[model samples]
Target: MIAALLQGCGRGETPVHVSQFDAFGIRIDMQLLGAPEQLATEVAEQTAQDFALTSYSLGLEQPGPMQRVNELLATTEPFAAPPALLPLLEQTRDLSERSGYLFNPAVGMLTDLWRPDPVTGKCSEPPDDESIARLVEAAPTLDDISLNGIELLSDNPAVKLDFGAVIRAYAADIAVANMRARGIRGAMIRIGSDLRLMGDRTGQPWRVPVLRGSGGAVLGTLDLRGDMSVVTVGRFQSPCFRNGKEYSRIIDPRTGYPAQGTQVVTVLNSGDAVTAAAAATALFAAGPQQWGQIARQMGISAALLIDDTGHIHLSPAMERHLQIIDRNAQVSVSPAWQDSGPQ
Candidate 1:
């Protein structure tokens, strides 16, 4: 996971307030600058509580709102979508469409096929090809799910919902907004490998580590300022290994199998973290050959991809932001992605 090495103290050397807490099934590290210690602590507590509520609402394994929604989806009947979940689903569906469904969250059954052992974090046996093919043929997608106002329903029974891919970024966006609302000017939220930055860091840009892969050595650092998101997707995210081959947690919705060909892909966006996170996943699934095209479709300008062969590919925009450390590392800069709009 990437860590924001908070450089320097708070403004005028006031000392930044740092807090660490576990929520949404991951550890969240928050650093707030230009705020009183008491105020920062209160904001952190409130943000943690908000994350708890989001977890309860969106969690599928637990007996909560999302579970109930999934149960109701099985019957193919219209029901009122939970207030907390409706907007998120709407946003995710739009993102899915933008990525040509490459970033689908409706393949919960497909995801469950590759679920890892909680303690071992690995699947002892790889899912058989037949099981994967069945779900792929069923073709469950966010398109099958419909929303009208607060009412929601699914025409396809195979379409199950899982927001694990984007919720952390979504939560971080909310936290950052709440922090800004409270008059705090500078802060950063590091949720897993994804980071959301607000304002500046003691009048300087935020420096965040960019790993080669999940838990892999640091490839370089990205200097970011203002409101932006840096999201990385890699094989170490829920990987399953059987024998010697590794299976990534990022599943190709069309193939119902773990995506391959790309070791890691990180996208930086001056937009909401949710879109940035989804683009990273889609680009990873798109593999090295098609990442640039899919990234263009998703309106992502800055992205870096490390292919399976260890070659580093950078978009023109990304090349400007990242400072590569290894002078001998193979690097190629792609042309700027012109906005042709979504196809």
Candidate 2:
């Protein structure tokens, strides 16, 4: 169990108290603002338990329906139709087709191979290239897995659905929904580094500091006062080896490899943490070129991209929300940045 406590005054009322806990590796931080002490305690305890059950994959001891489907895709021979796996299967299939197979064979295969080891807490590497090549040759198409709520199997079943790219975002969305249902406003939910913000902090923007180092020093800050969901993805907070090899926990579903290049990317969505989370991870994996196209396609409100060179690129929408505070050196937004327009 990992835990941290935050205490600060808000609205000149009693100090706001927030306690974050990670049980079974489902990260959650609960903030009590202007609430009764007893009620806050109860809410925190209950919320923690709820998040642990629904969001923590490791906590799901027995294979739930989802896990069962995942297992089926892993082991059993291909069937005609798998009813339980329909939703995920359909989503995977659609994404595969739309992404022009850029996301299909690679992503799922890699996830299956390098998923974090439960005991070691480290991600394993993919099988040899020859093995991957053979698997790719025998990969199943999206159409192959689309069964219309029925069970189906194929003789060549090399492909599988690895929703690791989207699961954290999904969990964030679930947490936001649950919080809203309970009438909790003016709060932020952070699962690992993914986050969702609801309401304002006493009419002021909620300032979330982005840390570049693992020690949590401020790299920058985002002002999320409105009802927006913000998700950040990067290699910053992940573990690093002394040999100069940095491995991000985020895996690119396409090639079964850890996402590389660029330091960080933050995606802001108006109301969907899940979408924001997915976009952040996907954009990071896709890199800047693909990310720009996606930003235009998705109409993302704002974005911040930091690369290995320490160059910062801010989307047009992000300028309004940025206030740089580099006391030691001059850090300027790039001229090519859309934000640096005529004004």
Candidate 3:
């Protein structure tokens, strides 16, 4: 999940404050335009602290609220939900249902099986078929977990909680909200490949380059206006290989295997970072044939998917915003998503 941010030219000599920090296992880049230097620095520092705290609380491997929740879930017993983590769990549960279970966080057991080495960021080998089959048979889902008030319990012990798919984006949304509350309107918050934009960049629309592959050439650029979220999901790093075939890190919960048939999926949502990020992952899992259906279900109008065969598929809304840079690229457009209700 990577997109290049093209900085806008300065106008009227308004100060542009930039800050970079490491959080959630990735680098976070933030920029505030047309704000007083002291205020921008204060907001950036505060947001950085918030990001650090959120990452620590939700960390999967560390001793934190999420880790404690997983422990209690494995016991299949009722326990008090961590106050800080409950809201995120509730939000993702709703997103999972909206995506028709395509963006499930309940597949943590499945994800753990395919977890990459911390240093290499690649799995040495795929999980054994038997192990995958056993978990798939259990069919753990968010539905198996019951949340009532502050209490929670899982009917199936196999259900584990992992928020890696949407945590960065979710945190970015929080940071943005905080910034807005502080009266800072012009800003950009990037957590990993998930980006949140507010207002314009020095009175110019934010220009983002959508890359074809990780460290690969740009496919095109998106000119985003006002507040928006742009997120891309893919196995940007080298995937695990066996028998000369590559395996993606994005797993399909139903099959207990890495999703195939699509190399990358990018989604744009207005003022909703979590949905944008989660929808991209879900669309990737849906692959080429069903991505359109899932995108419509998630209420995502702007999306672009590049299949493994190097064909470009774009939703009608995306085609309008994206300026194609690869002239010879084969492109196909999907019909516009018809929304049934407010998203």
Model 3: lDDT of residue 263 = 86
TM-score of model 1 vs. true structure: 0.92
Q: Rate the local accuracy (lDDT) of all candidates.
A: 0.84, 0.58, 0.83
Cα-based TM-score, every candidate: 0.92, 0.74, 0.92
Q: Compared with the true structure, what per-residue lDDT tens digits does model 3 show for residues 237-339?
A: 4467766877887989889999988888989998779899889989999988888888887878889998888888888788888999988778888543433
lDDT of 3 at 147: 83
Model 2 whole-model lDDT (C-alpha atoms) = 0.58
Candidates 1 and 3, the one with greater lDDT: 1
Candidate 3 stretches with Cα past 4 Å from truth are 1-11, 119-122, 335-343
Query: Candidate 1 — which residues are off by over 4 angstroms?
Result: 1-12, 335-343
Tens digits of per-residue lDDT for model 2 on 168-224?
Answer: 555555555666676666666666666677777656778876545232545667777
lDDT for predicted candidate 3 compared with the true structure: 0.83
TM-score: the better of candidates 1 and 2: 1
In terms of lDDT, the poorest run of 10 residues in model 1 is 334-343
lDDT of each residue in 203-322, candidate 1, tens digit only:
899999988764568888998889999999888776778789998889999788889898888999996999999999999998877888888878888899888888888887888888
